[model samples]
Target: EPEVTQTPSHQVTQMGQEVILRCVPISNHLYFYWYRQILGQKVEFLVSFYNNEISEKSEIFDDQFSVERPDGSNFTLKIRSTKLEDSAMYFCASSERGVGELFFGEGSRLTVL
Candidate 1:
């Protein structure tokens, strides 16, 4: 089955540096989303994109963050300035049905020093 895939399972970065997390969502999925889990915290939604535009976004998606579909198969998230609080496991998810269950990637772990 097709699945979402994220690169660089772990990353250690310095504060204020920019980081780009990469993801390849399922080929036929119609909805894509980004969520983060702070170590032991519950998953928090960052943004959701559909039809080539943002469908929903949470407060966590601030000026420092951005998302884009750079190609037919890749979905990317860029953080302009890293902060200690930004340390978390960022997961990429996709679903064929808009309201159906989402399939998640293993996640890219971000660590800011």
Candidate 2:
């Protein structure tokens, strides 16, 4: 079955650098999400998109972060300036109806030094 795929499986960057994580969500799915887990912490919701627009976002998704669907299948998450605290595993996910079971990518690991 087709699944969400992310690039640069792992990345190491200096603080204040920019990072753009990419993903190709399931073609038939209608909703997309960007979630992150800070090392040992629980997964946190960053943003959700549907119908080509963000449906909702969490407080953690401040001006430093943004999400986009650059094409029919490509979805992306950009961190304007990486911080040491931003180091974590970022996951891209999709669901057929924006709820219920979600298909998740293996995740892009970010390391900010």
Best by lDDT: 1
Provide the clash count, candidate 1: 0
Candidate 1 lDDT for residue 86: 99
Best by TM-score: 1
Per-residue lDDT of candidate 1, residues 42-87 (tens digit): 9999999998999999999999999999889999999999999999
Considering only N, C-alpha and C atoms within 3 Å, which residue pairs clash in candidate 1? none
For candidate 2, write residues 1-113 as lDDT tens digits.
88889987999999999999999999899999999998888999999999989999999999999888988989999999999999999999999998799999999999999
Model 2 misplaced regions, further than 4 Å: none
- Each prediction's TM-score versus the true structure: 0.97, 0.97
Once fitted onto the true fold, the runs of candidate 1 whose alpha carbons sit more than 4 angstroms away are none
Return the lDDT, model 2, position 56. Answer: 97
Report per-prediction Cα RMSD to one decimal. 0.7, 0.8
| Model 2 C-alpha lDDT versus the unseen true structure | 0.94
